[model samples]
Target chain A: MNTAILSGRELNYQYNRSQRQPEGGKAALANLSFDLFPGQFLALLGPNGAGKSTLFALLTQLLRLQQGDILVDGTSIRQARSAALKSMGVVFQQSTLDPDLTVIQNLNYYAALHGMSSREARARSLVELERLQLGDAAGKKIRHLNGGHQRRVEIARALLHRPRLLLLDEATAGLDLETRANINRHVRDLCQQQGIAVLWATHLIDEVEAADQVMILHRGNKLAQNRCEELLLEHHCDRLIDLFGRLTGTQTGELTT
Target chain B: MNLATASYCFLGIFKRELHRFLQQRARFASALVRPLLWLLVFAAGFRAALGIAIIPPYETYITYEVYITPGLVGIILLFNSMQSSLSMVYDREMGSMKVLLTSPMPRSYLLLCKILSTSLVSLLQVYTFLLIAALFDIVMPASGYFWLLPAVLLASLMLCSLGLLLSILIKQLENFAGVMNFVVFPMFFLSSALYPLWRMRESSEFIYLVCLYNPFTHAVELIRFALYASLNLPALGVTAAVTAVLLFAAISAYQPRNRPQRGKPPS
Candidate 1:
């Protein structure tokens, strides 16, 4: 396989608060590193406060790097943020779409942010919305659309720039099961067909298929990383749910009651 | 920063803000109403109570309404600045701010674009107010109307920069109200908005000098001079310098994509 499309080395980040005692600052991410291969779908599994969102923020350049470095297609994020961002698409955990704007307008505005002309943006937006099965809702305001449709619009907006890598931070959190499955299938197909790398952050282990790579993060540290099947077998757990419990040291049987 | 890219970023943000204004029609109406109420009701009530003094910009005794037009303009700019900052906080909470800040453009250029967009909206509101003022026979000289544009632009820059800085420093929307009560009121009141600096000088030279140093005072003075078809170099210089400083401070405080530190989480 070609070199990883995105990689981070010794990424360390600590929250600095002047009002806190000298030692009170929290280390959100500590000496963590990973590489995402081209065309591979990698799911990051972690519990709440496991630094999943923090890592996403750092990767997307929302937060400055306090230590270490990130590379996008071999260019350092610090040295070439614009070029790096150009190659990456991000769907944040929260909704970034304007509620007042129609689905098409939201996508067009995002395209403009990337410096694309209106004509080109409209053409691409139509194609992307069609591909996402949201063409019918193109003219509806985001506030009028259901959560699932709104999420699809966000996905369509992210792809308008045609980035080589896609970063999704809980992109399907509030969607219904059927809608979530459809989104996952579409994302999987996109990765396979376009040779795009994907890093999907989620707490649910079922979201990670047997064929895909899985990175287990616990308390800001990467505990294990491998194909889902290999990880399950190595832990002597036949099911992903059981394996997830073993890996994260959570009480597995308690939920059955 | 590349000037072309900066211009593009500026235009993009400007368009977004304009769209926001169109979407929030109620907000625009409310913004207009507050100033109109002051111009009509409050100015009418105070016109007889307040005595007038001949200032440099005014050759003859002017009505209280005419004297306070520049101050009311400053009020529009002030409120718009606070609204812009409030929206910035809302954007951050909603995550759209990340999309704008992460663009390849320099942080300062992005902020300047935000300021420009906000100021454009503020200027639109001010012109509308001026039109109404004209209907009421409070209009300045025709030449003064032309100078209003640049004066308004400078005042918008200064206030918007201050708002941008506040947005960066304030972690929560709740605290912004306190800032409004403390910062906005003092700046508006202590400045020569309601009275001339010379009037304040008779009471206390220190208050006069403080007013002289206030960027808002300079903003009002600049507009006052423009209202007479003249210029105020000191006011223009002070406003520009303060704008540059605040803009620089705001840009320097921006931290790419990194999440700002929220206060201590519950134990």
Candidate 2:
């Protein structure tokens, strides 16, 4: 039940603000480490600029790992990047779909990128689209879809490969509360039913549940990591907002209730 | 990479590019018009101003239209290659490049496949321009058209590789217009594209020397020779060498290890 699907050890990342001084100034992620187990929904809670997307970039092989080891299903990303990436899927914070193409076309292109046959790609894309309730819109151009629908298409595209690990970098961003809740529920159901491990990066505290495993990242540091209830108990706060405030030294009512 | 997977990657990218090219009517029109303007208006205006000595590729005196057709072919390819680079920058901005780069295939193979697909699209544009030129009675040897296919393909690959290198060096899409002006203009003007090397020499020795060294000049000369049913060994050698070097440089620039902070969040 606790088998690790993804693990990173002492991961480090830096961002040079100025090109004139490329030497070094501040690190974006400082010696970060964590593990995600099969069928686990790890809510990677962090404020903006907390290096959530940076970490996702490294895990997805969009950026080469600089200073540590990242293993996806026991395959090292540094040494066996293609093999490691093959077992993972990612939905970036930004919409990556081509607006000019139909939803099915975008999904089929992604499936082909993973070397799936045309027939397999079409069948899988339809199944995923139907699952996302986007079956009727598959033939429509992405530009015709709303923000929530576009995000759904992106998610369906990501799952077409049936990867063991799904990484969502603020996947519910820019959606209304109801739509955000729906996406969250759907992804959580995927974790439970498909046994796929998920690492959901978000700044919203409300999206987390008391039973969910949570990792609070602030300013590139892991401030807290445990079950949500445990963290609430540890910080002696019933709400995650208060716990986040106490951990990060930020007093705000942004994530209440 | 496995053969099946490689074919799939190649075909998928090719189809996507083709689809996008077809959908953007303005882009297609501009790609064709740029060369047509050079072939019809510019060449027609310059016809009386320039004189043609019997060159190796040309057994006898040829009209300016025939002489500049290959060069105009080069232009179509040059613009298309740069357009491909533009799309690369746009894809990076849209975050779609992240999806592409994260695919299970080796990055180098995928990058090469992208260049090849762009070359294929550019090849189609060249042939379209040639067919239009043929309608205007600027015909090459019957067999020259077939022979020129390989030469056009090689030149397209070389130019596309140069564009890839430029895209890697360029950091943003908003700044690419400046680069296009800086690169595309200098390469087109200082090459054998608009005028022959002898013509350039008659104007200025230094300018002629620059044209002689420009890789685009060799690519033009290569296409010219092939279009006349003869092979220019020196031009072929030089263009091949430049393609190899530029391709290596572009691949090196594309290596993730070289740019640690490449996948920055969208602004």
Winning model by lDDT: 2
Q: What's the residue-level lDDT of A30 in candidate 1?
A: 80
lDDT of each: 0.83, 0.87
**Minimal lDDT window, size 10, model 2 chain A:** A16-25
Give the CA lDDT, 0 to 100, for residue B5 in model 1. 47
Q: What is the TM-score of chain B alone in each candidate?
A: 0.92, 0.96
* Steric clash pairs (candidate 1): A61-B257, A62-B256, A62-B257, A62-B258, A63-B257, A63-B258, A64-B258
Instruction: List model 2 lDDT by residue over B83-119, tens digit each.
Output: 9999898887787888788899887788888888888
Flag regions of model 2 displaced more than 4 Å.
A17-23, A253-257, B260-267
Q: Write the per-residue lDDT of candidate 2 for residues A1-257, one digit (tens) a residue.
A: 56588998999877753456644646778889999999999999988888898888788866666678898776677778878877888899988998888898888888878988788889999999999999999899999999999998988998999999999999988899999999999999999999999999998888999999999888888988999999899789988888888888886453433
Give the lowest summed-lDDT range of ten residues in model 2 chain B. B258-267
Task: State in Å the error of residue A196, model 2.
Answer: 0.3
- Once model 1 is optimally superposed onto the true structure by TM-score, how far is the C-alpha of residue B162 displaced, in angstroms? 0.5
User: CA shift at B157, candidate 1, in angstroms?
Assistant: 0.7
